[model samples]
Target: MALARGFADPVHDAQAVFRTVMDALARPGLVRRLACGLAPPAPLTPELAALALTLADADTPIWLDPSLAGCAAVSAFLRFHAGAPIVANPAEAAFALIADPGACPPFAAFAQGTPAYPDTSATLILALARLSEGRGLGFAGPGIRGRAQLDAAPLPPDWPERLQANHAAFPRGVDLVLTAPGRVAGLPRSAQALVPEEA
Candidate 1:
């Protein structure tokens, strides 16, 4: 099978994507558009491919969830374009691509970094079925002014509880970037999920 092409302008496109990623993280629970110019293989979405191209490198090891790992084309595409090492161990990865959000592992399953070097934690890039509409979850913390809401699904039903614990871990936790088609959103470790009664 023929592989899809990467960004038309690597320098500019990557910069745009980087900004989008940053903005999403900066404004937790806010959605942003990723005008990624790639059409990667099945299971590997444009947003995920764009992220892999923009963030992954030779030094960064990436872990793909079973859904994505089983796709040979997705592996080949990332290997060819990102030139990043694919690791079998999630704890050893600097980044992880999750194509099946419902089946994705808990935050504790991946690297949660150390108190001294919290930046070493793994970042999960989750592909969601609908980021624009779902059962809304409220968030509050650092990046958010008061509180913010997001509706990305089908995430694990325990996500709110999981995220709360992830936040309580403070400087040692995993961050999440959610994507759907051309849309992207962030749920950084600093963002704390609110219970329904509070939302």
Candidate 2:
């Protein structure tokens, strides 16, 4: 079996990916391309790989969905490159990687930090097929001036409702990183996902 490839230039590559993640989070609903070269195991894209490299570290515990968890190559790559420990329990994880957001566990299943320490909440990294092109949902909140439209298809049908409930928790909700082939988007706890009104 071949070992998965990590960043060609660790420091520089991680910094670049981190910048893109920060921009996406600061400008919720915006789609950004991650320009990195990584060949992680199956179901892991360049964007997702960059995200895992940028976010996970020695102190952070990560949980992978069944498929990814079963892949020894993926586990070894993450462990060696990011120095992140893999945990079995989702609630104990600071980060959770889900290959199929449509089949992901409910929002409440992951850690939702307490009001006093909301920063401890889990961050979910989701691998999506492709972001919706035409219609999806409207986003409103902090980063968004008025509103931003996002086409997030293949997500569970009740995602909007689930997100609404999650947002109601204020500072105590999980954050999401949605990644495609080379593109990524952030959906912070503060962002509201709403169904677009009929035209």
| Best-fitting candidate, scored by lDDT | 1
Q: What would the per-residue lDDT of candidate 2 be over residues 1-199, giving only the tens digit for each residue?
A: 7778799999999999999989988988888887888878876666767888889999999999887888888888889888999999999999999987888888888999999999999999988887643356888899987878778756887888888888888899999988887788888999987765569
Q: Count residue pairs with overlapping backbones in model 1.
A: 0
How close is every model to the real structure, measured as TM-score?
Answer: 0.95, 0.94
Q: Candidate 1 residues 1-199, lDDT tens each?
A: 8887988999999999999999998988889988897889988989999999999999999999998999989998999899999999999999999999998898898999999999999999998889963348888898888778888888988888999999999899999999998999998999998876644
Clashes of each: 0, 0
- TM-score between model 1 and native: 0.95
Candidate 2 lands at a TM-score of 0.94
Worst 10 residues of 2 by lDDT: 129-138
Q: What residue runs in model 2 are displaced by over 4 Å at the alpha carbon?
A: 132-134, 196-199
